[model samples]
Target chain A: MAVLQILEYPDPILKQLSKEVTNFNSSLETFLKDFIETLNSHKYCVGLAAPQTGNLQRIIGIDISRARKPHLNNGLLILINPKILEVSDFKIVREGCLSIPDFTANVKRAMHIVVAYQNAKGEAKILSTKDFEAHAIQHEIDHLDGVLFLDKISNPASDLFRRVRY
Target chain B: MNESKNYFAVFVLGTDSPGIVADISKALFELGANINDSSHTIIGNQFAMLLLISTEPVYNTETIQNAFQIVTQKRGLTVYTHQLRHEDVYRKSSEPGQLCVIHLYGADKPGIVYQVTSLLAKNSVNITDLSTRRFGSESKPIYIMYLEAEVPNNIDTRKLGSDLNKLALSLNVEIKYELEEVASL
Candidate 1:
């Protein structure tokens, strides 16, 4: 297994929409191995997407167990063509992308989610998660649509908590 | 040849009007000045603008002020220009620190700003941006303040939180602060 180079911001490839993975073959397995290797190579990185590595495919690798703080998570997951079936609850989380290294923004995301995806063998599967794992999933899925965390930022003080004039 | 002294701080103040920005920018454009940083705001019907601009070394504050004379006279505006020092040309990059935002609101009272800011100063927390607004009826005025500060690595944040909690109790205000954490995805 080899670690692939992660692309940074201003790379036009990151903004392009990723294509869906139709064939789950030997090449898909090889890419998943490198993808997991790349995710593990970075310290404290819990999630990674295909577009981040210049691959325009609907693939994501996540393991919230690697987070510094103890959080409820499934050990390791390789999700292909993941789609959010349901999203519930809301939370404001500050996130920094590996691509956009310089800034972090407060983004509101779902606290719980139900997702449908396919495993490497092309078998259909579904995962329901909440809290940190759910947050990581939403962030990775956004990459499939060429959506960056910067697009969903809310002003820390004034945007969500504006006071009503009496 | 004297490229070292090409920066100037320009300020414009006048009654609010639709074309104030257009006229000011037009004057600067005609003078071939590059606007590096600028902020324009409307405060109680007055238009206030602050700009940091760079131009050819031959142009100075006097020349810039003279260039705005026509616009100033026609628009009933006042313009002030000061040549910036060589050291002030570039802004200092922010130090690596934890980004935190503090929001507080309470019944209008004196010393709220002073008390909060002094505490931050003593702790070496550098404030990046701060805004305060007053609301409510005359008899029961409400004051709200939001400030974004950077906490250096050396500072103990838990202790600071407790200290802020104590201050909140004494001041009878609701103080809430959140340290923004960047989760790598």
Candidate 2:
């Protein structure tokens, strides 16, 4: 497996809507493997989306197990054509994206979420997640719709902070 | 143009008005000055603005200040401009640390800001953003402070919290603090 390059902001590919992953062939498997490899390359990256790596497909990988609070995660999740069914409990948390390095903004995200999607083998799956995991899933799904956390900021003057360093 | 020699820190303060920002920004824009960084806020009826600006080398601090004389006169604003020193030109990037938010509030009293800030300074905590407000009824005024700071790696957050709690007890105020987690997605 190879680690793919994550496209940064202002890249046209990052702003375009990702198409559905309809093909469940070996090519799809290969892309998912490379996506996981690229995600694991970073020390604390908890999630990644297809558009982030220049693959305009509805796919995402998330593993919040090694995140801040390990006990509150679901180990690893690979979703294809994911759709959020229901969300509850809204809260604001600071979020930074791999595509938009060096900046973080306070974004309001749902604390609990129910999402339905397909697996790599084209099997339907439904998962309910809360807290950080839920936040990560929502963030990744936004990439499918050409949305960035920057667009969700309520107050740019006070909510945006320049990260010290990557 | 030598941008390095033409950097300045500009401060504007006066009664709050609708067109204050537009008027000041228009003046700076017409003078070919680029605002690199700025913070503006309104407290009650007063407005305060702090900006770091850069201009072409030919425009010195006096030239920029004179350019705003008309706006200052018409708007009844107090303006101050100072050429940035070499050390002030570039702010040193912050060290990786535990970022935390501290909230303090209670009955109005003296030495609240002084004591809290002094304790943080002694512990090498860097305050990045701070805002204080006096509210509630005038008969029973309340003081509230919210600040974000970076605690160096060497410091223990538990110990810092305990110390702050003790200080809060002595000052008869309530203090709450939590780590500001920035999720790297």
Candidate 3:
């Protein structure tokens, strides 16, 4: 069991573009497991990326099960070398990143998204997500491309400060 | 510059214009005042500004209260100043759960905003953000109200939408629910 340290923003590692995982072997398997463990170790965190833990690879881990939330039905979805095929109508979302650590941004995302990627078994697969789940997938994908949620926000007037309410 | 000194909370309300923000900031700035944080908005014809500013209290609330009040009255703005305590500096814990915005617009009449907000109150929905205004003329008035609310987890969006749809028919108003992403800092 490996719990990787989350790298915060302004760290050059977080800005690095993640490379595609060409070889899905045993080493990749260990990385995926460690990513999931690290994600679960944090409080109220539902998703994580390879770059989040200082790895510059196109690997993302997601799990949206919330103990406090009732309507959410989400689980771990690992995407390696993922690509967004199409996006539905644009919808704005409030999102905070593990990379940025403190500030949250009003990110605009597609209501529905179709993504093509490789699964854990190295088999190519495609999936479609809508609403909150779609927003999550896009967020992780942005990390793989070195794009943070702050980059996607439209208006700074709506930007917020003070991480903790004071 | 009174960079490290006492903090004061000032409440100003009246007709809003471009110079209102600049004038107040200019006065405070020249007096070596540092604005810690502030949030103000214009609703209808009135602009309300609440500022948390810090400056060396030359004499507590009575110090600049008279001078600023005179200036405020001359500018046609109502002003109330207070010496901020430690308790007043921090905001209390806000309501939990997701914040959503509901917008309603249609023919204006009695009991539109009242009936809509009353239904929300009945459902234990708290409106954290609200801005309402009337457009058009006396003969054909149009009412528009935008409300940001905190919705508990137990409620389903589909049911809420359906209920709102039913209410729209009875009230003769159009309503839309936009799940505002409030968690975004």
* Candidate achieving the largest DockQ: 2
Among these predictions, the greatest lDDT belongs to 2
The better-scoring model by DockQ among 1 and 3 is 1
Clashes of 2: 0
Where model 2 places Cα greater than 4 Å from the true spot, the runs are A66-71, B1-6, B84-94
What tens-digit string does per-residue lDDT give for candidate 2 at B34-141? 997798998778999999898887877789889899999999999999988656765455465767888999999999999999999999999988999999998999
TM-scores of the models, in the order given: 0.78, 0.89, 0.76
User: In model 3 chain A, which range of ten residues has the least summed lDDT?
Assistant: A157-166
Candidate 3: tens digits of C-alpha lDDT, residues A1-166: 7999988878888777899899889999888888888988876676788998999999987666632343344577888888999998997667777677656666778978898999998899998877666777788888888788767766554554333331
Per residue, candidate 1 scores C-alpha lDDT tens digits across B67-108 of: 899999999999999999876765444454666789999998
Name every residue pair that clashes in candidate 1.
none
List iRMS (one decimal) for every candidate.
Answer: 10.8, 2.6, 4.5
Which candidate's TM-score is highest? 2
Each model's total of backbone clashes: 0, 0, 0
Instruction: State the DockQ, from 0 to 1, for candidate 1.
Output: 0.31
Q: Which docking class does model 2 fall in?
A: acceptable
Q: On residues B39-135, what C-alpha lDDT tens digit does candidate 3 reach at each position?
A: 7888778988888887775646666465466558767888888887766675444545566778899999899888878877777776766778899
